[model samples]
Target: MTTVLPDLRPGGGRSQQAVGMPELLQVIWHETRTSRAAIHRARPDTRCDLRISASAPDRELIGTILLDGDCACRDLLVDMLVECDRHLSDRAGLLGNPLGAARVHVRKKAVHDWIRRRRTEVGAQARVDRIRTSALALGLPDEFHRALLEYLADEAGVMAPLDSEDALHRRLATRCAAEFGGAAEHYRARVAAGMTLVERHCRSGTRVNAGTAAEPDKVTWWERYIERPMGRRPRRTDKPLVTAAPECGDGTHQPPEPASADAADFDAQVVAVLVAALRRQPVTPDAALRAGLDDLVSQGLLPQRCAIELCSDCNRFALAAKELSALR
Candidate 1:
């Protein structure tokens, strides 16, 4: 006798009694013999030839049962299938259509969800692998590596407000240079290399480069003072030089410049003062002038009679040095 099997439902549910033989066979193949062992044991006897009529829904249900290892409803489906098959065989008049004419529809949501989940997992693993590889390649000490990672994360947080990725990268480089005591250009190069490796392997398309912000220039204390219009004056006061008695013939004492001296004489005296100031190797203009005057007096270059006149000339030279130093 040719027994027609019922069609299988989309989700492996029991077939309806009103449905034809095609649907019945679908249920038997998909819901009942879902496993290889079940299929082997449930084979029909040689005298009772059995034929299956499977639809698209039946194929999908069978595929899902085979693929999903943790399908909790399989036992329930198997029990339902056995009951249906027994009922169908008991009624000899019932008939099922051929498998070719059967049409079945399967819900695609589960399949789609499974694919999406797999992709997400793959992407997450790729990211993890990329990070681990990059970290190992860095070869920094464990403590330093941890600190560097923390610093980078903190920097990224600070840069979150930046609208442009390029700008953010550049700012990060600048900050890294300042905090880590490395050249910004070098830091940028390293960052770029790391990002490139990540993008290539992880398939993340994020791009970052160093920012254009310039570091502030350093100014020296001397430069700071000299840049000003009025330079700092010497703090030291002039002290009288102790000299040997003239009777010893160490040097002749020249007379001081008279108040009524000619303009030429006054100009000559001013020139002498500046020449003295330039001779000293002191750092500041004020110190230079003071040391110059002291050297001239101690070396007996200046006459004892011109002590007052030379002192007054030294003061003028001090002012002149201030202006010259400021320009420099």
Candidate 2:
């Protein structure tokens, strides 16, 4: 029987074979984002809430717009932002030269914090990535592939192999029967027969034991388990949307005040993005910040002047002040 590259993985358990690509994406997105949020919340605070005085300069209101998928929105946002930046530079030139630089520095720090947080979260997400890769390699969708690998990894040691023809025959029979009983019984019988045939003909490739005592029923088993039966690809599951929440250690009160929606939202979004970026090894804090800023700016959720700050230790965003309005 011919096996697709994807079907060759000898081991993911029944459950792993059920997870599809979309589901894997969702799991990765959720777990990475969640961990990032938690770590950010736990980070030590940075006093970034700048006091906006009565004489504060007017600037453009910027926000990030989030869209599903790895699409072309990023390029579009960059083009638009480049065009809009002339006004910002001009305004900065007017701010006595040094103030503009200072403001830029502050914003950079905030963005850096966002990147650091992502790296932190990414640290916890390696397993998801590996599982997804394994699934794709095996030609299984996120649902069955990932779930099966995870199940096997968790239940049986990840090192276990499922390559033996005998093992394949037995498991496939059991799976077919369990998942599709009525039609599968016929499949089970057919595979059993094939196993018997392969055992007779194939036997040991080196040892031509054509006349030996029943050759392990290899051909009949292979035919019944692999060649004859019909197999249905499992459906992929939809990933549930996740909400990024602040952790208790975030130094901010839970259920932020209704009036403080702006700050709270800003905090949540920046922290979430930051956390997501930090998952990379040999992490780049600046790149992570740029990622978060780009996400927010594209979404139109942040003003041009707002900034994000990272904690030195955990590399996630930190809210230094207890009061939202006190600094802003």
Candidate 3:
């Protein structure tokens, strides 16, 4: 006979150590896979497969779950976030070749137009912020909170360049990652130190989430049916999310700008690349600007201001450096 695991949900106390990040992630994926419908609701929530949508309507899809206190589907928030990011990136030429990466470079104006066209895609941050609201209201384990924030910060870095309209905190966090070290360490530290891009939401809107359990416990049922590695499987979430057939690179992404298109649009792409560089991820500002100037400048950008600006001036760059010197 298959034996069910004991309830191991951590009590709201320090004595119980939170599960490690890798294991916590596994548990979350499993919850996403196995989510069930609540017994009662205005309409029987029919999204049983839990396949997440990659379009604007995903807000409604995720909202349906987070707001429905009866199902307590908030636990799947992390996985939902993961799926959204993957779908968006994949659709945006996530492949590293210049052509693919170029296709990934969707301009902000076009980003809106693209979304307007048919709700083709969604970015990760906004949706995760929704989860952030719930996570804050119904407390999460300390490590879990930090990890969630770190994940947000990391995703912010990944998505920052593609869209310039990103939050300043997130942009700066990625900039810090670029200036200091890289996303994994620098922003991870900031998030642990209580800095993150998560802005506060309206307090009154959170009331509907009250009845749901803070986070559902994970199951160890896999240990019964199979070995540790392959045994684990996630249940499908009850409320199904939209899914689509794959496209070559990004389905909605326009082809690379033609020679006739405004050259400035192509020049702006350097910003995305440099931002990535500063964050030290895939590598994007001065660097971006230099590239833009390299192509646009008839005489090319000046190498220096008489080669003495750094040595002679008390400019912001100089002042900034001196200020930084105070750190150590």
Candidate 4:
């Protein structure tokens, strides 16, 4: 008897001889991860020293190396330190210190405090910008936008004395729906988006009160009526009916084309695969693109024939996952 060995090439198993593009992508991803892990293990705890310099108004500094594993923070500290030094030298005798050494300490502390305050203000402004952008995207009115900013700034009290921002937003959205006659769901979505923006900004750093600006455009009373629910209009029987004759010429009307079952099944399969992949691992852009595709292919949900179209769809899903992750 002659001994025969099985072909062990990519996708050469008994199931299917040709590998799908998604499976090939998975192989590449696995190899890439293995290589990265090996490289990380080979050179773990590697230290890097960086030197940064900037030109000041009246300062001549050669260079300084910052160490502490956070080069960006160190660079910022050095810049702030140099700025304080310049301020001290400029106001040598103005601060009642002839040698400028005694007041240097005080001036340094003031400079650092100023920087902290400025950073807080900038972060607050960023949060306000995000809230405004979200409101604009939701098509919220100018009055509602200002109210949201005020709420974020803690300038207004909640209706039911709620402790959390979420509760406050819910109450405010309900009030907005009642007052504006707009869709409650739309207002709730806008409020949620605004609250999320403020919460994310607060979590990142110290919270500061956001300044409120005048509304960009004024809404007239007539414009407000547009948001209100409109009554059904009466039907008119003025036009005569005009139906086209059958084009087949046999006097038999051809039936309308039915919806594609294959397309619907493909979409449902794609969603199922994405949900399974996300549940397996937290959805990230990289993980969704590679591992998600791998999961779909391995689970036999994605067909080899539809690999190319599915790959494009997977890319879109990956981008959406990234945006959702960022919001979280």
Candidate 5:
């Protein structure tokens, strides 16, 4: 799935990268201008409430654009965000001020408590980069040519490993099936093959095993889920997205039930196979994020019901102040 992201100026690193929220908002708004209004007219289902405001505010206008704007531009702005939360750990080891680790942890959590659409995008990008690299090294022939690993870069976590436990993994697989108009298993197998190649290479080289995972005190991603961003990506914007999903902490929500027993069973089997395969591979960031979730579950630190419930309440909120176009 070569996605071919809209000319989001993927090479746009000069002035845009350094700009703050206000400027970034203006830039994307400018870029998405014409397409925004057209889409509102094109998609009558959006029920867009068009109101002209001469002095409303750029923030509110951006929110309206993102809520009902073109998907391509919306995706591009998501990619353009800079991940700025300095980390205390990654796939490497403990980093930053260890003496102030607790304080830093709190501060980082505070950052996460803000908009996280960018960080989530970063995670998906990270998965694509590493997995794509591993795919090349293993001579998998253009990734055995798995799905091109590009679409997810624009959307959500579509590049996730087939067997991994991230929320969007199955969503990608399902979409792949729909896009190709069937051959569901073939698409699923491509995803699995990408992960399998990583496992194969790691088993053949120096790597970490489950023993290091045997820590009695619950090591957490502190050992495994380090971010180690090369250059910070996806910085937070000052405002939140007014159209973002509800947060997980709310009590009046419910976890999404599976469409059927068969679908649920299929997802469970995929996870089981993926867990077994990855144990033979290295605990890189991809391994850690996916496998770490499993460890948390097995240790009873994160129960299945709790994890499922959070998905319903929605851990997927974007900044109220993000992305392009439509003005009415």
Candidate 6:
């Protein structure tokens, strides 16, 4: 006669010690034999088969029951198999995932809050300041509070004017922009760069050698000479390099000249390469610039300064280094 294992659900509720392989085996047997939902929910089709087994005994160790069964057991065994495979595959990171990382982050945050709350010696202002610092560290945008407040109000069923659909949407949009604008800009730059490259590569059709291009300095000089003329016609009345006296010049600072089509094309290519790199990962300004520089280097163009920093300086990107730096 097949002996039935005891239900074990309530008896196995809590444990001071960590779970081990033996406990896992008990849980699986209990779940399969007693829990109708566990088996019925995992209805395996004809194609799949379930199998389980304990690892082969090594010196001084005994082997536990290995689960082996038909399709139903195979489906259930998949979870265990994955864990085993992970150990064999990449033992160091076998079970790591983004969701697990996020859970750890949230737990840490809660622990920090609990510790702060328990410190009776700390003043309320100090507590508030600590929270603000933590928020800044987590890269919470300034606008996040407004959106959060609105959301909480709505969730609590508060009938406040600010909870109106229009107000809520506006609040959400503002927060999203503040939180994600930099990331969005980086993504946009990459897409634009890729499209430009595809167009150029397709249009050019023939491979061109970089050796044919003029030296970078020669090119710069030629551009300057072409754009403007050299003449010793008039020496501007002596102006000291550093002086308290206001430097005399035309009231208006000249805007940057429109780029030539070729220059624009080169820029588009650089943008494309950097954008592609950013899409793959969050790049440091140095890394993004390096990617752009690599493309320029390949094309025999002078490497310009870091692209993101230049964009920041020019007020092209919504968020600045100072803002993202706050997160770090």
Best by lDDT: 4
Give candidate 3 regions above 4 Å deviation.
1-122, 129-328
Task: Please say which candidate is ahead in lDDT: 1 or 6.
Answer: 1
Instruction: Estimate candidate 1's RMSD in Å.
Output: 38.0
lDDT of each: 0.39, 0.33, 0.31, 0.40, 0.35, 0.34
Which digits, one per residue and each the tens of the lDDT, describe model 1 over residues 1-328? 2222234332222323344434543544452333323323332221212322243265544322221222323332333444454444444333353221121211123222332333233221111224323543244444333333334333322202332234435765676678678787777765555544422332222222212347443432112211111111112233456565655365765533333358776556555654656554334555455555565556554555454453344335546556545533
Q: Write the per-residue lDDT of candidate 4 for residues 239-270, one digit (tens) a residue.
A: 22223356787886543332335978766766
| Residue-pair clashes, model 6 | 7
Q: Tens digits of per-residue lDDT for model 6 on 112-174?
A: 343343222121111333333442223323434433322322222211223122233454445
lDDT of 6 at 193: 41
Q: List the residue pairs that clash in candidate 4.
A: none
Model 3 over residues 87-109: C-alpha lDDT tens digits?
33344432333222222332223
Indicate the TM-score of model 1: 0.18
Deviation in angstroms for 103 in model 4?
6.7
Q: Model 4 Cα displacement at 166 (Å)?
A: 10
**lDDT tens string, model 2, 1-328?**
1111111111122222332222222232332344334433432232212121212122331222222222222222222223223323434324333323323533444234443433333221113335435523244333433333333222121112332234445555565456546554455565566445433432323332212376443233212222222111111111122233446685553332322358876677666655564444114333344455445544555433343322121112222211221222
Model number with the top TM-score: 5
**What's each prediction's clash count?**
11, 67, 17, 0, 15, 7
> Where does candidate 5 have its weakest 10-residue lDDT segment?
319-328
